[model samples]
Target: MFDPTAFDNIKFMIQAEVYDRDLAGLFHVHSRKDLVDLATLSRESVITFSLKDSADLRVSLVVKADLEKLAGELLPSSNALPGVSLHILYFGTERSLMAERMDLLEWMWGTERRYERKKIDSDQTGTTYEWHVYFERIITEEMMDELGDLISFIGESLRTVTETE
Candidate 1:
């Protein structure tokens, strides 16, 4: 399950640079009011309603040369970066049911051989077959965790095979 509240406090930083004065002409068709309106709606506080509509969301411009000075105190370089990618495979009983419930498909069809019991009448019963199939991939924390473990297992298996050879 994906939780929207996990990112409630996260703040995103964006910086843009325009090289030439002629580039400023590109916005000639858009009035200053249009730019202000767009920016007002895009601000984190405004979009999330963290603050009132009157709150200031204006960003102060900094010269490229000044960025180095600011970076020395505010940002630090990292020696190593973490590399991780997650892949999820979702499974459901029926294609139509999965599509209706989550808009996904059934994957690895006809794998399970188990049969389930279903009631046909008060004195009789019937057997029903079911298989877990997945059509789409969903990215979430739980799925990522499972993917990480699966990847680790595959990596270890490959390493062992190569070492023996």
Candidate 2:
């Protein structure tokens, strides 16, 4: 059982042991293009994070988790355990009004093109983004089924290609 108290205490948790660095997801994107032209020509907001390697003995240096998918699996049940009201607080969506309000930010910058002129303002300098998610369930047989299926698939798929390799 996961301790709910840990959520209030820990701000972040480090993930460990990932096999492939080249692939970002179940899919792949392979190409290089102008960042600016892509932004104007495309809708995706690109961001990158470069991590410094750690030398700690306990750290093996790879992390992978599809929490977005996992959260989808952990939906709230209509009925919950007695005295344990399982709360699945999902944000990063319209349901989270406070989170949405906090994310309301306007970006300001000098426009190089006439098309972007009116939108750019000097006071605001960057885009705003908000995200939140939660998973909840009382210990139950049906809940175990969801977890079992997810575990079985991951274990079978990311396993060895060759025996004893």
Candidate 3:
């Protein structure tokens, strides 16, 4: 029998939730990548999407699991367990209100996650910003049920940050 890793399960759950929203007309799927590093024996998956009405802002959900995590789950004597780190990234040209938006995201994601914003590129016209929300702890299979709520919160965050204040 073949078994799926925690990373695989979580990635599928996230994709299903996002694609469901795409089908319902709330969001549009842009790009997706599922990669495995043969040398490191690590896995990473990224899914990018945008709000239905706004294509400028791109949101990406990334899930990654390294070899140590996978080995821990596969080996019965290992004390460590398998898990994936979840990161949500936003790309857009909204420099003026970035501070406020970061604050709003911090509040929405709470204190467990670390947030960072940096200018990825800039030109005379405007600057492109990338905001990343990194979940501090490893997300295991037990936390699978939170996938839907996480997607919902992300949607709420999109609305909150883009709205005129």
lDDT of 3 by residue, 40-109 (tens): 9999999999888877778999999998899888998888778998889988877533777777777877
Residue 114 of model 2, lDDT score: 19
lDDT agreement with native, every candidate? 0.22, 0.22, 0.86
Instruction: Please write out the lDDT profile of model 2 over residues 1-165, one tens digit for every residue.
Output: 874222111111111111122243321122211222333322111111111121110111111122232233344542323211111111122222233232221111113211111122235553222222112332232343343343223222222111112
Highest TM-score model number: 3
Worst 10 residues of 3 by lDDT: 93-102
Inter-residue clash pairs, candidate 1: 105-135, 106-134, 107-133, 107-134
Stretches of model 1 off by over 4 angstroms after superposition: 1-136
TM-score between candidate 3 and the true structure: 0.91
Instruction: Identify the candidate with maximal lDDT.
Output: 3
Q: Which stretches of candidate 2 lie over 4 Å from their true place?
A: 1-14, 17-125, 136-165
Ranking of predictions according to TM-score: 3, 1, 2
